[model samples]
Target: MSKFDSLYIAAKEKLLAAKNIAMVTHINPDGDCTGAALAVRKLLLALGKDADIYNEQGFPSFMEFLRGDAVFNRYTQEDGVEYDLTVFIDCGNIDRAGKVAWVCEKSDFIINIDHHSTNPMFGDINIVDSTASASGLLIYDFFKACGVEITLEVANFLYVAIMMDTGNFSYSNTDKRTHDVAGDLLELGVDPSVLTQKILRSTTYNKLKLTAMAIDTLHMYCDGKIAVIHASKAMYNATGTDSSDSEGFVGMIRDIKDVGFAVFLRDTTDGKLVKVSIRSNLDVDVSKIAAEYNGGGHYSAAGCSIEGKIPDVEEIIVKRLSEEL
Candidate 1:
């Protein structure tokens, strides 16, 4: 049995027992969080119940198709909604839900499903396994365990969630079981190339322009083992793009030759803060570095936010990376 087998049964039972159900995505909804939440909503509907998906922001621009005309189905935290059971998908902690964290108070039961190692086990019924590549795999297991049919929509949703989080299955987290779930999704009509074209290939002009400007800021340390790239507020204003446009900046630079660790620092929209994303291609755990800054993630990928000027924060992170490397 899987580590989450018992939790799955309990979650399934609670889901059936509850009438008012709300599915919540984390703040800064990525493909994994958004897709898994939406997939669960579809799963709940297939099980003879309806659910509403809420996020701090509705959805990222890249996955707007998933939120098409979701009028009533998609909601924000400002809605001040209450539910008997609230599901937090792919969130490491309640705070990751941003303002929507309050729903945990209004919710009698909270089901936390995630694959992040840093998760705090905040759920009344937690189905968390850091071993899994993505939360989509866990939700897929739940669907299989319940003997529910995985529809095309659910399959596609799972595909995006898994594919994106696994970096198109090229990241270290990809494993035999990851592919097993993906193969099952393919049987359910997931088109890999089409998804790749839509998600990976369809970068906006502003995003590419922003990337170019950020690339100009690239700096190397430790004999090129560590590379740092940044996007300042000025770059965003110049390119008419925000942080969302620069989603894969760190990973993109990590591919550069001789660069094992890549860091991307981007200034937040407001305040004197910089958001940091780190990715590693070596055996080093980048998440530990993020933890020192009060953030967390996986061994190979992680992030944190720092309160400082972007240049200062960049220097601090590069020095830290130098020490770690």
Candidate 2:
């Protein structure tokens, strides 16, 4: 049996043994994180366990259609509540859990479920598969192995997790097993058209305006081999858009014919910290770049937060990425 199989069995045994459970994902959660947390929440509820999903911030409205009401308890030190077990989905390290890290520290048992290669194996039980498209897919397999029914709700949550993490099956992580799992989910009534429309095609007017502005300021570097864009705090105020609306803007630069790398820079709430998201089509390992800033993720897609003005952050990233070019 594979290591994942062993870990899955051990984790399942623990789940069956636990009473109160809490689930958490990384801060600024994406599809994989939210979907995995929701899927696990549903699965634990099916098994007659108390599972609560916790995250510091809310997800974008586009992801609201997934499941479990996206009920995230804001992370705070004074909550004074602890769990028999805490399951962290799609978070590589404890710190990624943000303020919820305190909750994790208080748990009697911790389970770290993720697909990132950089996972620190911080949990009492770490079930990480670097090759898996999404942690939700692995969790789905765990439920299946444990003889849990694959209900429509579970299928929908897992589908969103897998679809988004693999870029709708366009990323290098897609494999035969990924397709097989997706096919099974489809048979179980995952409405691809509806989910796609809700997740990808639907956008508010303010988001559209922000996208247009981002596109207008798109800059090409390395002789058009790299593209970069920035969204300052002012941009959000001008467009009446939240930082969440900046999602997917980097992909637009990736469409540039000759560009191998795309970077999106945005000033965070602190104004002094700039969030840098990097996407690469091939060869260039953006994870390595993100690591330079103490961040980690997949080779093709990664992100980091830098303390600098937007312009300075942009110049630093461009200079660092030039080495890869």
**Compared to the true structure, candidate 2 yields what TM-score?**
0.95
| lDDT tens digits by residue: candidate 1, 53-128 | 6777667878877664453233334455678999989988887877667777878999999988988899988888
- RMSD of candidate 1 to true structure, Å: 1.9
**TM-score, predicted candidate 1 vs. hidden true structure:** 0.94
Candidate 1 collision pairs: none
Residue 127, candidate 1: Cα error in Å is 0.9
- Cα-lDDT of candidate 2: 0.83
Q: Candidate 2 on 103-191: residue-level lDDT in tens?
A: 88768999989888877788899888888888878888888766789888888889898998888888888998889999999999999
- In angstroms, the error of model 1 at 175 is 0.7
